[model samples]
Target chain A: MNAVADITQSRITRRFAKLKAEKRPGFVAFVTANDPNPETFREIFHGLPQAGADVIEVGMPFSDPMADGPSIQASSQRSLKFNTSLKDVLAAVRDFRKLDQDTPIVLMGYYNPIYVMGPAKFAEQAAAAGADGVIVVDLPPEEAEELDVHLRANRLHFIFLTAPTSSDERLPAIIARASGFLYYVAVAGITGTKSAEEFAVKDAVARLRRHTSLPIAVGFGIRTPDAARTIAHHCEAAVVGSAIVDVIAQGLNQEGQPAPGLSQKVLGFAKSLADAVHAAQH
Target chain B: MSKVEPRNSFRQGVDENGHFGLFGGRYVAETLMPLILELDKAYEAAKADPKFQAELTDLHKHYAGRPSPLYFAARLTAHHGGAKIYLKREELNHTGSHKINNVLGQIMLALRMGKPRVIAETGAGQHGVATATACARFGLKCIVYMGAKDIERQKPNVFRMRLLGAEVRSVDKGTGTLKDAMNEAMRDWVANVDDTYYCIGTAAGPHPYPTMVRDFQKIIGEETRVQILEAEGRLPDTIVAAVGGGSNAIGIFHPFLDDASVKIYGVEAAGRGMNSTAHAASISGGSPGVLHGNRTYLLQDENGQITDAHSISAGLDYPGIGPEHAWLHQQGRVTYVPITDDEALASFHLCSKLEGILPALECAHALAYVDKIAPTLPKDHIIVLNLSGRGDKDVFTVAEAMGEKL
Candidate 1:
């Protein structure tokens, strides 16, 4: 991955083409803030881009993320216990930005933290820190006009979700305002599973096609190569998150000592996912 | 689809299409993706494993008192002036509420996972007392986080938990209510994730929690189906229950989810009135959003921030409803209605005088709805009401509400 791309060009379009040409689907890895510890993030943030991650979604920890499952809940709790504030997360991203600027980064999570911090200020700090997009999970497209406007004004794409259950009537509005790419939730449930019926993926992608030409990225439950392959055949991109979190959790400090090869483990896993996407070539 | 049992609504949670009508789907964070998948796998295995189901059944029968009585309330029916009334007496369960059913299920899973410590939060003290009771029975170290205000008002339950050898932590931040207590409990669990199991009180958390809790509590409806068959020789015309985080109601309502002939009424605490700012009617006044681990309807502000709620009953003061309840409401199978504080208080005294049952303030909300709807129906109509808990915990609050002190 290049450290710097042409600033004047639409980098998202450029990155999409390069991945498609290489017969490799784009990967967006999502991880909670301050998992294990904040300091450990230095390696995770920098290593992901080098390991072929097209995008990184950093979770902004919230006290009550109702949409999050136990693993993420635990991660958020750990992060919050270490006092991983919005400011702290921003600083980590800014520092990571200095190391590499090509890979687009999106902060994904709940809306309470951003609301408490003030949306305008959050967008400002996020944009200034070199975040390419923001996906507030709880902030639905209908309720996110102001936040979307602020982020767009700062040249940051506002990512939105189009679920299998989302009505055809609501798709156009969601697709019209959405940037970066539309996150088409392949299954009707939480993330982590590698197996969901293939028909569900195809149905959602088919429905989304009738609405917009924007790239449709299937996420939630797409964990392995087979699942990614099935999803990539129907959508433009495939997201793998829980499988990576599990790997990172395994690489955690073992036997009361910090794992020495933490960065190596994450990069190895990312490379495996990238390889999986590439191996699924038509 | 017609079943051998002849059910009413659609069974959409079966993953054929991944929905319960337009309500149930996986809307969650990426970090917990693997854990949820694991939980789904575990649940699937547990469901098919007779050993797992038998163990849960044994615990329920011996510990939580399975098949809690279904009594005919002839006097309450007469007082209502028309419809026949039956009470599913879950209050007689191990911890004096319907919460024990789900706690037992979760505690068994916690043990299976080799988790050593059990943690939970409570507002009315029913779930806390029940969780503590389960931990005591299982010989697990239990820690319960309760809001400071709840602790003060629910001293007897706090003492009961302590007597059961569980540590009770009081949370004093963020309105010092159920939501804050939940936040603190989640934080503690996260801090001790390696050894501790966060036994959530209600079927309102993320993914498997809501699904798992519902399954455990479904025994209510399962038993009620047989009990009603024997009692009235037919299905009741209506089923009424209170909706505090909506666990008990959902437990009783799930087996009947597809039973179209049975009209299910979930009573939410209106605090003062539906229009008042003090109400806890998330279904009546709130919109769908994500909070407390599920994408369900919640009483939130314009900015989508969860709002603090109020009710005379501590358990019914939550601003969010169970996701399944949201699904039921959207599917139009269950009618979500609000009963004001005055109505609940009046029902409490009336039920005490008429039936000699001092109903819990939370249950009183359901009773109030029964009082409202029963009189309007035909005299031969049957309405099964879930008396969720005993009113012993509400003595002090009831006294204050009635302008009488112990």
Candidate 2:
């Protein structure tokens, strides 16, 4: 697993083939950068793929990630406690590039860290670290031009968000410069799964199609395989972040530590979601 | 007072760039950047949508009860000696305060955004109750963050929020008051940026919020303009209201911002005294910094660690003033004055005794200024004061402050 070489464009083909060969839907998993421990970041990137995560989004922790829910916020708080600065998240990405890298790794989270680091430095650091893309949760389409140009120059994809409330007029403007995929927030609310039945994920996905031709990946509140399957039929991919994090959070052992089951739980959940996606595709 | 309906006074001091007279700009953590920009875009469309405005208006009228009355206080004015006094009775509004005016609008916007949950922070708990009411009415899951200290002082409000189906989380951090509550709320907002709609209780927070919340609350002033005319046949010489995060003050002042002849006074709480350490007079003594989301006058240190705020009135015990108030204060369009805890208490008692109206401790600060200025004014001069909230919730706290707790 050459981390740097693995993330190169050529490797993405193989990564895509592996998922196709396994008859599993490609799963993009997002984990807040430096969560639990910044030092163990290499493990998170390497471990996630082994656990059935096809693409990994390492969330660059920010002081205010407005799109996050309590669990992710707590994850960020824990990361910040270890003095996880934007500089550190970028550094971890650079370090991760030293190991295995064929996985499609995108940086996710807020704009403040990027703003603080300056767009050029952030872009340079991200590109140098072999990050494929970046998703700034709060960057509006109107104000993303400067960021979009910088990320593109550095060969990092600038991903944009589309929500249930997003209109046709704003959708193209938001995703015009987007690379990789369009993240359609399946639920109107923040990140984290509630009752799948209560939050209409299918209606949200159906609405997202009118906006962009890019591969629409639905996220937010896709906790169950059924919910994932329900979303997969309407969208190209389904993102499961918070629900997986919740599994890791719940599987913590008596020592106030994430035990062996954390990995198993995530792998099983991802597999189920992939199965749901496969089921829907057929 | 010109027989026109109370309405939004479509004003945007911040241009397309989101500035409020150099006071408000996006000053936030990196994580919130995308979300703020997203919110800004959504708010822009919502602001221009006729359907959005109509829906908000409908909620304001049917749900929150708009156009609160403008009643002439004949007895109270005579007691003041010379000035004719009028009260814009916002206390009579549903949820018992002017806080409902903005929440109804925000909640409606949230619904339009397809947001399923609403989150807010409160000090005196009036805002919390109003937000909870909106959440309940709109069928959204509501969560309110309150300072642990405020929870103790404003117990009834906490209970009311619970009854309204809001999960009240007591933030036991920092000074354990409004500042801490705001910090906790911001943390929550950052975490839940995906699906949660942050119902800012005041005209504070980030760029669009200060401007948007002010626009929503301006209905108070718009209505006051017409109601005063119907009640008095002319615009009052003065408009006065208490300033916590300055929402009500802005609500009453925004309509009259262009009316040069109408003087506006914003009453700030001079807890103990402004000269002393015990005070919540941000404009009177504090400097500008970023907190929660926007850059505004904050009672904070150089490191942006917010300081402790003190006031006899829990509602007025906040560490920041609304951005618009800072602009108004600087532009000299309005005077930001402070009344001591003692003065506010005296005014509270005076209003209860003189007009048979028990004002909220926060509103008492506004009353205190009237008490002082009315005696020296000309007989024909009329002053319109915003009775921001009812005193029922404050009775127990007031009793304790007066050393006569029930």
Candidate 3:
């Protein structure tokens, strides 16, 4: 596919290129949009870039997140209480774009919300709102054509997930339609549930690298800075989702309101992870 | 509109990509896709294997009590005073429900695939009990995920599953219903893909599952077809069954789909009413969306967030319907109607009083619809309703609904 050429000049492509030049692995921070509250989430979104997030994955909350573990599921529930819509998520990206044009933002969630909004409209709106890519946890390669076509036409990257269970015979089919990067799900389970062994992730990344030139980002279990540092040593980027979401969950008061300095506290955790990832060397 | 050429067969469906028109495709995470595809291949092989067929047939006859009598409900037929009603006695099957038919097939397939542990999700606990029983028979480990609220109301079935040597895990997330139980089950399958076979209760999940479950459960319709023809010398004028995830309904509906002369009706639970938000009527009240690994009619909000579904019957209280039901509904081959809680309760009592048989609340919804249309048809007209399960597990709920302490 011409997907690689299509996204050559995109924000995601540029960020990874810069990371390769610096000889440092990138750090991707994930947080549910409007989590805790819209205003607090906005502050966290704006602060992510300065806190050293090479790429940002803004979670679009849905009612049923089948692939998610307790942490991300709770995060989505908290975000939904504020009525976080896809439009609101896009608007967050748009606002973030005004302050920092270089940081790449990818919206991650299930397919039902995007399917409800209409695929073509979602792609157009996402591109227009300055989002660079999408990672639909439930939309595997087999069922991705409808949304992928629209994303390709909009010049936005459609990131596909490769799991530990994704066999070598299946890698070709998965990577054939992939763009931006391949997200190597470190664990065979749902998000935030189990940590991946560094050796296993290293081997899996090596196997994936032999097939494509796309940058690989490992996710699903890297929670602490040490784990992030070790995982980042193998892939182009290390992604931490539930870990940061857990920080936000912990920062919430008993009344379900964000305590004072919750945004700062979440950003602080992201900074520590980013520092560890950026410090990774070959 | 121009005259459309009628298709040769309505039974042919679900293209290789696991779609029924715009519905029913593999919409699971990448983690489960390879395993689901593997399952599809195993199922196809088993379908063509004479040994597998013989074994399933043997189990159905000797183990689960096959050919559950197609009882002629003479008293109810006279009470309706119009259509001669027949009840396909699936309730007489082992475990007191139609769930065993599909469980027997799937658990046998799990053995073939060498997956020793089996996991399942249930709202009414009928499917759990069936799976647990199968696991006990086969000596495979069994884990059943049940919603906390469902476990509370369905205490007897929960106890039955435990007695059958299954571990029951309570899921308290997302309104603590079937939807939540399904989510937990998927998580378990994802985490334990190597040895665990996810025995989905209904025909609603991803491909191979919808088709596989229907294939196993189609004995209901196959038997009904033969029994009705022998008794009435013709196919019934109409066939009615309740749809939750639509396993039982699809089982009976698939065999008669090609018969143009026969009419079909699928009932959905309208908890309070269709006008009110409380209901499990996906086709009648909701629209098409993807959930639980397949694209089907779902009770979702404008933002595509799934809404909680309500029904007096735990078995019928799910937010989505099987993709095949969505296809059949869209094709206009099967008419889907909503039956309210009060209507179902009345029928539940009426059928018991008239036929000396207590039908499941899920089946009562179908009887409620039959109660509406049967009286309007001629006495010579025949209508067959699937008695999908026995109501023994529902006595406490029914008594409470009747405001009785017992």
Candidate 4:
């Protein structure tokens, strides 16, 4: 509707369109910004596009990440240990935009930091930093308008998460407010705790498709390449977060410092998952 | 009474969307949104149902001991030589605290909703014990999440919860305090939404919780109103209560909010001093921020990261206050003050020596404030303080603070 919205929507919409043209599902890689250390995180982030990622979701670290599982929670803690701020997360996006312009970048986290920064300022700064979308985990459609208006004015997609508990009656409200893509949390539980059955996701995605034309992205408990492939078959994209973070965790020393080649290890796993997702039948 | 001018009522808050002047709302994940809405509907229905009220009243009178005595502290009043002080004995409730008042109501709702499992989080294990006791009575599976540090400091309460047949799960994440325990409980509820009901201990969580908890615990103020009138032939001029998550304070404050003649005080735990970073006074020392599902005053850093709170009493060691308290503070309906750990400790010893009642450290914060204010008021002025909990669970922590090993 607005100039900024058009510009931001094109990045994500174009990527999904490109994937659709190739008759393949897109791969989205999620990582907490500045995790393990900013330098290594920068390296991994810059390599995601080359590793076949269609979109990048950067987590803005918060002290209390209630919706996240152990892996993402630990990664957030690691990032916070370095005193990573929201400014640092946007800076990471700016850096990634310098190297890769085509891949859509979404910043995700709880609302406290954004509320602290003021929603209008956060949306403006994020758009200036080249971020395309946002996913505030705790802000459902009911509470999204305060931030959504600012985000829409800035041309950033105010992405909404539709959970397993979102019934037919609830889907309409969520769909009406959602932009960019709908993140269908495959499981009703917190991230990485429970695996989503393929059949259940298929039915949920089908139900969502009947309501809106917006592309659906499945996340939560998508760990291995096979699981990613299976889930990507049912939606426009499959998001892999905690599993990729697990690689970074494994590459850390006992003292919690990043080991040598930690970035490569994380990027390598992301590549494998991406390859599987791209190879899946539409 | 003089001719009263028409005014807005403070009790009709938390509009259908669950807000109290931009302070309270449902700030939970999408997975819990539908369930929270369902809970809101169920609560509204139960509120309208007379049978629900009758059942809760029966349990309060027979099982949990309602209408606790309002006793005049003559010795303490004589010592202060100022206002006559009266203590509302919530410590005499079945679970040795006022936590049972809300827990019984919530546990009954859990049964009505057909939820088989009940989950809760606690700081000093008072709420955990109350939840366990209620679950044991109703034959529901109860799981209590307590911080590892709290489980150690509040070992007696942990034991009490376990003996009551509730599973006490120690949360080792973050600072292992009330906030961490709450985070873990939310995660558990999200993972097991269908069969589980989260019984929030404080009047602070998302929409319905803040309003519902206050409604359930409002019985304290209702009884206090009648008792004070019967004893002194008039309502007290001032009422005081300790505030952590602010349940006790809000419970007693809500009924008297519109009483223009009545004054209210909420005492917060200033661990060392408000000048130092170590304090749990959200109103006095913290800024407005979102935490534990509601927007309220919180102890947080510049980056909006929640900072740890410090208090001698675990029950008062929290980063955020109830949203209603935030709104009331903003509207100047109530006055909030800070009490240092030393001040509370002095009142603890003083109340025990003077009144023969060992007050909970949480309640001692209020007593400490009364010690300061009551001595300054005229002897004719009346002050009623909510003695919210007993000190048995806090004895070990107090002994340790006193540097006397058991």
Model 1, runs deviating above 4 Å: A1-131, A135-282, B1-9, B14-33
Candidate lDDT (C-alpha), each? 0.77, 0.77, 0.94, 0.93
Candidate 2 lDDT over residue span B43-151, tens digit each? 8898899998898888778877777888888889888788999999999999899999899888888988899988999999999999999899879999999989889
**DockQ, cand. 3:** 0.89
Runs in model 3 deviating more than 4 A are: A1-6, B1-5
Interface RMSD for candidates 1 onward, in order: 9.2, 6.3, 0.6, 0.7
TM-score for each predicted model, relative to the true structure: 0.65, 0.65, 0.99, 0.99
Clashing pairs for predicted structure model 3, backbone only: none
DockQ ranking, high to low: 3, 4, 1, 2
lDDT per residue for candidate 1 within B144-190, as digits (tens), equals 99999899888899999999999999987666789988877755643
What RMSD value applies to candidate 3?
A: 1.5
lDDT of 2 by residue, A116-188 (tens): 4567878887788777778877566655675777876676767777765566655666667765677776654
> How much does each candidate deviate from the true structure in C-alpha RMSD?
12.7, 8.2, 1.5, 1.4
lDDT for each residue of candidate 4 in B208-249, tens digit (9 for 90 to 100): 999999999999999999999999999999999999999988
Model 4, DockQ value?
Answer: 0.84
TM-score of 4: 0.99
Among all candidates shown, the one with the greatest lDDT = 3
Tens digit of lDDT per residue, candidate 1, span A11-127? Answer: 566667677787566777777767757767677778887776777888887766654445565566667667778888888889988988777788887865675577798999998
